[model samples]
Target chain A: MVRLITHNLLACHAKGCTQNNFPLQFKDVSIELKEQEVNSEFVKNFLPRLEWKALVNTARQLGDTSLPEELPDMVDDDFLKALHHVLFEIHVEEGAMVCPNCGHSYPISNGIPNMLLSEHEIG
Target chain B: MFETPLTNIDYDKVYEPAEDSFLLLDCFEQEYQSIQQRFTGRVPVVTEIGTGSGIVTCFIKQNILPHSIFFATDINPTSCSTAAETIKLNDTHETHPFTFTAMQMNLTSAVRSNKIDLLVFNPPYVPAENVPEIPKDLDDSSWLDLALLGGQDGMMTTWEVLNNLENILTPEIGIAYILFCARNKPDQVAETMKARGWKVDVVIHRKAGWEVLSILLFQK
Candidate 1:
């Protein structure tokens, strides 16, 4: 389940590949919308931990450009719902996550991510 | 310090907080004081391999090291859902917001090597008499086979982690708690620890039914 929230924390870890690793790019991503029971408090609670720029950019990349160009000064129900939808509801079922710098790609299939590196790629 | 299953779906599929799970919980729950004292000058990068239900990771977050960034992996896709639910449910309480993520991955695969501060694995230690095929989640089945089956001698999954520990673990700061019972060869564990230049410290040893389980903590 490669949701925007999970994608927000991922960085490239290919052997000897360091710079420009954070927020690996999604390629040919297929999104699945799952409707979770909305818990507004949980969404509000998680607001601080979010990397707003990374998340908004990711949402745009997934063809969901609903989020505001700038984070709203105060969160409202509509905004929170959008955040919840982007962070939790969207799932990348099939795709590849490519590093911006190294161009190393990790594929996601059957909704399971293969984060394994080759023996030589192990640092 | 365990989050009971959030729902029936989780209870039926995910591995619950059993003795081995609680042992790791107790090891860190009771020992976090000492761990913190020793780590006064250091920070922790905690990860749990085969993080069935994500209770142990949540337990670590709420009870032990709340600030550490936790990563978890499980082969079963549903387990990831259950784990994310568990963290979201349990982490909603009074404690600080925890940073944790569950990925459907094989052991230590997606996680970057040499970055984990504490790698926890209370693996499927029981030896399965009739080894079951890995579940595809497309048919009528229970994937608990992967949860319980540890091959002939019960070292199948643990062996893989032990072999890859060198590449996955942080060089000097990494500490791992690998739990095993009477059947898993202790000698092989000693050899693995020796190869890593880490002395084995038994964090906990107790009888859970017929098996005497030991949660071995080591550093690399």
Candidate 2:
């Protein structure tokens, strides 16, 4: 349930949320990387939609220190492999994703995160 | 692939037949061969929207060339997991280069905008007399309500898929291969695709059967 694609759209849906709150930072997250064969075409196709800084930072927090600070001009096999690992392999089996601005916590259990907010939190 | 009529055999009998009866029929082997022929060349990235038992997926992986990447998805997580397990069972060597990711995703939310090359769907197209009783197995999830029912005319799910195809499919290079029933208004589907400016083709047509599975290719 915590796919990076879904993670990109999720924000702190709490009341009175404003300004740079989202792309919530992961807190004390546990990750497992199941390496899949790198598809350079897919990686190249999906690069535009990726949030470079957020992804790199999240990967770093999850103990993957392979990506560069900035995306390189020529994306080689090595870069794509790392990108693949960052995107698909790492599964967030446990932990909470906290919104830096609003201070909302989305908890993860059994690799599935409960994103539904309480009645009071609903806008 | 050979054409077979759904009415030729009793639905209930074939659905839950005896072990000895299945041995004589060899339905699995025939289905496997049909699936293999579909993915033999140019190894397209295939995404199955309603991969029920994962039989088709396993068949494709086993017989097709090694380069194809299969993403088997279902609205039901349990169904997705079952498919994933089947994939693991069939996959002997990791070096075969097949990656099967079973994900719980709805049609509206799951797929990225204008990204998929091919979409395979075999939705529930049997139109009901009244809103049929929601089966106990599907009561746990809300998706089954819309996913299985084809609306008043039994083409509701088919229409939904067509509407979605307009957005998810690129006019220049996308194609959606779907299967529907003969009693479920195939003309409406063809008309919808034509109205949406897609070149439609009837790849497979079965005679004297209620379940008429046609692969509609939507191209620019």
Candidate 3:
């Protein structure tokens, strides 16, 4: 399941298209919430690894606008819970992750997001 | 390397090829240099679940069988990127249209069902009561828990894999290689595979530190 955790690391892999390729925009996304044992520590530890802006934007795109626009300087329990939900619970069941740079689109179906690109797109 | 392969990997982030990883690679190497015969006639559709650093899959594709498709999946998004990087770095002929891609997926959930010719996995097999629950210590960022925490008896994830073995494997030609430690109970796991009518073998094993890790191969 592609929560923002997975989406946060994705970038358009189209050859020669580099800048602004990151954080592929979600289109027509349908999310399924699968509850996970909230790990406050894991979330706090993982926050530094995330692209904060992309995460917030993705949560909104998926219709979970509970997150603030900015990451709090100190990650509290409430923030950790929210981060855990955003990272592990949300599943992108069906959608198209459209590249912001080259406009390349990777489709997600049955909860598995396909990252394979065509010959021309292979970097 | 998508960026860096074999070396310079941030092991703290993506899984570094460890004892289990080496054992899995040795099995493949031995298979390639077999004294006997071919397991399957055709080129296989290859996949590796939880391909932390993508080294094992890359080794098979590059040195062992250079002309085949490769699919690697990981739950950690960073590992997927790391796997892709490793694939790009290790591929001898990238223009071969190597259908090499790394995906963020749980197990083989996103894979083409039952079409795998050669499937590989070195899962979390460490025994712990609170297996899936991340530790309460905020400073503990190590992903080993995610990669090594196998519930009580260390077979929680293994059972899930076996439960779907029939459906996950190709009807006639699927093969899977999995890693298990002494705590994971290789004998019992073999029995489970046998119960499912799978032909199983302990391909290779070695004593690494206090743990004895073995690789089990299942074929239809």
Candidate 4:
């Protein structure tokens, strides 16, 4: 599924499209809120690996404005819970991840992102 | 032993779990303590490339790292679809903070640099006259050939992942378990990786009929 955690690790790999390809922009996405157990430690452990700005921007685009503009110094229970929800709960069921650099669009159907490029698009 | 996740898997398209897959499972089971030790302080971002049926990743999640964030990728859309279903069906630990996401991509091309904490690959190790090319159609049945027919030496796909290892794996604690058949020249491959400063170990090996399958554990 296209969770924020997975989206955080994705970048466009189209041929010769090297600049500003990260955090593939989501368009026309249908989100599903899956009920998951919130583990504070798990969220905290993954906090460093997160691209805060990209995550915040993506979450906002998906209509979730829970995270702050910048990561807070103090990670309280409320913040961890919010981070957990954003990373694990929100699943992009159907959508398209468009690259900002090359304008290549990867379609998402049934929660799986098709990152396959055409022959002409392969690098 | 962990139960194999085989639900909704289309064997005609996705490569079925055989000796190579089971050998990986056995290696993980034997080295469970060391594997757990590698991720003692943090939650790992575990990814499996060429996840045919998602059994290997599912086995790790169920038996070893239940709290990890899992990702599975395959070139075939049908394999990705079936693997997703397999993950969903075997997700019994609802209380653990774990999630499995499947992606249809070529190797780790789209995955971020140095983000994967643990990686697993059971690549196509059969020596074929011609390695099948990746098809543009996501649902093409020809994608199955890409899953079984490795290049002349059965190392074309495996080398693709190895050459890009530094970009995909985390520097310190990243670990990878990759399967190789005798035709792929496992020892020579191990020597090359060792020369590059990666700690390599042949965790387990078995003579499965015509194929001598072995799993190589690599740490950087």
Per-candidate TM equals: 0.68, 0.65, 0.62, 0.97
Residues B123-158, candidate 3, lDDT per residue (tens digit)? 888888855643334235655577888887888887
Q: What is the lDDT of residue B164 in candidate 2?
A: 72
Q: Summarize candidate 2's per-residue lDDT along A1-123 as a digit string, tens digits.
A: 355544543456566665666677787777775666677766666577567887787777768899999988888888988887777677776788887887787776555454545557754
Candidate 3, clashing residue pairs? B1-B89, B2-B85
DockQ of candidates 1 onward, in order? 0.14, 0.15, 0.05, 0.87
Q: Rank the candidates by TM-score, best first.
A: 4, 1, 2, 3
**Native-contact fraction for each model?**
0.14, 0.02, 0.08, 0.88
Q: Pick the candidate with the highest TM-score.
A: 4
Question: Order the candidates by lDDT, highest first — what do you get?
Answer: 4, 1, 3, 2
What would the per-residue lDDT of candidate 1 be over residues B52-135, giving only the tens digit for each residue? 878888787777776555678887777776777777786555443234667766787655456676889988878876445556
Q: Which residue pairs collide in model 1, if any?
A: B45-B117
Where is model 1 more than 4 Å wrong at Cα? Answer: A1-23, A28-96, A99-123, B1-9, B41-43, B94-97, B129-133, B138-142
lDDT of 3 at B147: 81
Number of the candidate with higher DockQ, 1 or 3: 1
Error of 2 at B81 (Å): 1.4
TM-score of 3: 0.62
Per-residue C-alpha lDDT of model 2 across residues B162-181, encoded as one tens digit per residue: 87786665445556767666
